[model samples]
Target: MRKIYVVGIGAGDPDHLTLQAAKAIGRTNVFFLLDKGEAKASLVELRERLIKHYGHPHKRIVEGRDPDRDRTPADYTGTVADWRHRRSLVLEELITEHLGDAEIGSILVWGDPSLYDSTIAILEEILERGAVDFEFEVVPGISSVSALAAKHRVGLNRVGQPFQITTGRRLAEGWPEGVDDVVVMLDAQHAFTKHPEADIYWGAYVSTPDELLACGPVAEVADEIVATRTEARERHGWIMDTYLLRRNR
Candidate 1:
């Protein structure tokens, strides 16, 4: 049987690549890439750099256009589902045409596969359609959440307490019930601004050369974060950020 490795490459930092992920890259027969256009060209470059350093000498790299999606949709869940389905079809074709029997192909993910990434789900959808046959393994990498906490030198949860990881959309809706510590990702709207009373540990492009970090009571630093994030996004054309919000008990 052919094999597919969903390898997490870490959040924008070459150093974050783990030993297992390196081995997977070195063993890969093919690497599939989805181009997100020039606005995020650095991301594609990072993948290329890793493949060059650790991948097999004769590894073939294939490219596919990443399916576009609505950033702001009236029906968020439905829109995302449709987008994922489209992406699954794209990747299905890539695997069917490129991957040969008894060879290994890989999809290098930004963060851990178990996080917000859709590669795993896309693979599953392809299998469900009965169009592909391959066994896959997920190689975990450091997540931005973990990187944020580490960069800030802080723990995720309080003693004997649990922390919740949520998207900025849900955080904008409202804080989760009964959790003092909340980690937020994909927060395009700067949802942390809503909870001015809470303390925040925030980092943009964590573990990368262009990393930016800020922390303080939201009331004091919300404007600063917004300004920094906006400026950075304008300068880089994209930004990936995560933050932890701690509420005083």
Candidate 2:
């Protein structure tokens, strides 16, 4: 039987790689890299840099692409189902080719595997098919939300209050009904513009030397975030950003 280790590399910084994640990388015989096409090539480069920095010689790197699909549709659930199906196919193909007998393979995920990541979903699909006998291990890394909070020197939630983490697409569709605090990720449309009540603390490329941060009332700085995000993305060729929004009562 083989094992697949899904290790979070954290957000764009080699130091963010946890000790356990580092060990997992070193132990794995093969490493699979997911390419999000040309728009996010920097992400692929960042992962490569971390691998080289750790000097892990036993690992062989293989590249894979996320399934191309129309993710924005009237039926969001159906769209995601199709996308997952495609991803599962790609992962299965990669595993069959590179995973030798008695070897462990690792996929370097961005941020923590538990947060808004689809690697596990793809793994589940592979498991459903019973194509390969394997066990999955998740090595957690510091999430961008934690990094954002740390950079701003603030807690993610207020005393006795709970916070919700969601994607920008959901936020744009509507505020999460009753959540007091929301942390948004993968927001390409600047969905903060939809809400006026919350205070926003936004950071782009948190923990990296080129990190950019902006914080203020949603109404006050929403445009700034949109403009900044656009300019930065244009300049850097890629951006992995996360933000926290607190609804003040």
Candidate 3:
């Protein structure tokens, strides 16, 4: 039987890789890196840096690109399911080509694999099909949410106050009622524009030398963040950003 390790390398910083994650990569026979195309080539480069910084001489590297899917469908769940299926197929193929007979194959994931990452879910589907005999293990790393909080020097939640983790799309639809603190991710639409009254702290490329951070009353700096994010994305060709919003009580 073979074993598979999904190791989170953390957001964009190679130093963010956990000690355990680095060990797992060093012990693996093959390393699979996901390429999200040119728009996100920086992500691929970051993984390469992690490998170069910590990988062993014997570990072989394999790269795979995720296929683009039109996610504008009405049924969000259906679209996500379809996309996962395709991703699983590609991953399985990569395993066969590079590590079919190896004792272990490892994939380096961004951030903690359990939070908002689909790699484990896709691997589960591949396992269910009985196409591969492997045991899955996850090595956690620092999450962007944690980095966001640290960069802003603020608590994600106030004393006794609950917080929610949501995406930009949902925020654009409208703020969730009754929630005072919301951490937003995958926000391509500047969803902060929707809640102009909330206080916001935003960070792009957290923990990296190129990191950009801004904070103020949401009403005061929301437009600045939007304009900054737009310009930054255009300038860098990619951006991985996260933000926290707190409604004034």
**TM-score per candidate:** 0.98, 0.92, 0.94
lDDT of 1: 0.95
Residue pairs clashing in model 3 are none
For all candidates in order, the CA lDDT equals: 0.95, 0.86, 0.86
Candidate 2 lDDT, tens digit per residue, 69-185? 774579878988888888888889999988988889988998899988888988988999988768889999998899999988889988888889998988888888766899999
Top TM-score prediction, candidate number:
1
List pairs with backbone clashes in candidate 2: none
Cα lDDT tens digits for candidate 1, 48-89: 999999987899999999989999999999999999999998
lDDT at position 77, candidate 1: 96
> Which candidate number maximizes lDDT?
1
Minimal lDDT window, size 10, model 3: 95-104
Off by over 4 Å in 2: none
Q: What's the CA error at residue 58 for candidate 3, in Å?
A: 1.3
